[model samples]
Target: DQQVKQNSPSLSVQEGRISILNCDYTNSMFDYFLWYKKYPAEGPTFLISISSIKDKNEDGRFTVFLNKSAKHLSLHIVPSQPGDSAVYFCAASAFAGNTPLVFGKGTRLSVIA
Candidate 1:
């Protein structure tokens, strides 16, 4: 079974709108979570991240929120643009350093103009 789950396989939002992507994890050991955005035929790139200790982290138009009690997290993008369309993957790491990350099946996001 997957340790992490994106639940939604795809999402669509109009330009200048807000897009909310959700993720849930089954493993309690996970202490860190990161959101990765991938384009066609390209590798996933880090977008935003949050630690178990932090409930929310924001970077410009992107914000990541962690709900430890629910083992859930969400990525919010404000004013979603066409360029923001891509596959988003949620990843979790248990210990610090180079530990292997558990990844959820990515969710493809389409930002329509």
Candidate 2:
């Protein structure tokens, strides 16, 4: 069974609109959650992250919300731009210096201009 899951295969939004992506996890030990955006032929770039201790974290146009009790997390992008189009992956890991992240299947987001 997959520890992390992204049920939506894809999402589309018009430019300047908001885009929301959801993720769920089965592992309760996971304390660190991260979101990464990947483009074709490139490595995933780190977007935003949240610790289990915090309910929400935001940076500029990106925000990550974590609900520990529900084992769920969501990523929000405000004023979505065309450049924001990419595959988003949600990853989780137990708090450790070098623990590997367990990743969910990516959700493709297309931002139309």
Per-candidate TM equals 0.97, 0.97
Q: Which stretches of candidate 1 lie over 4 Å from their true place?
A: none
lDDT of 1 by residue, 32-81 (tens): 99999999999999998888889999999999999999999999999899
Residue 43 in candidate 2 has what lDDT?
100
Query: In candidate 2, which residue pairs clash?
Result: none
**Model 2 per-residue lDDT at 103:** 98
Candidate 2 overall lDDT versus native = 0.95
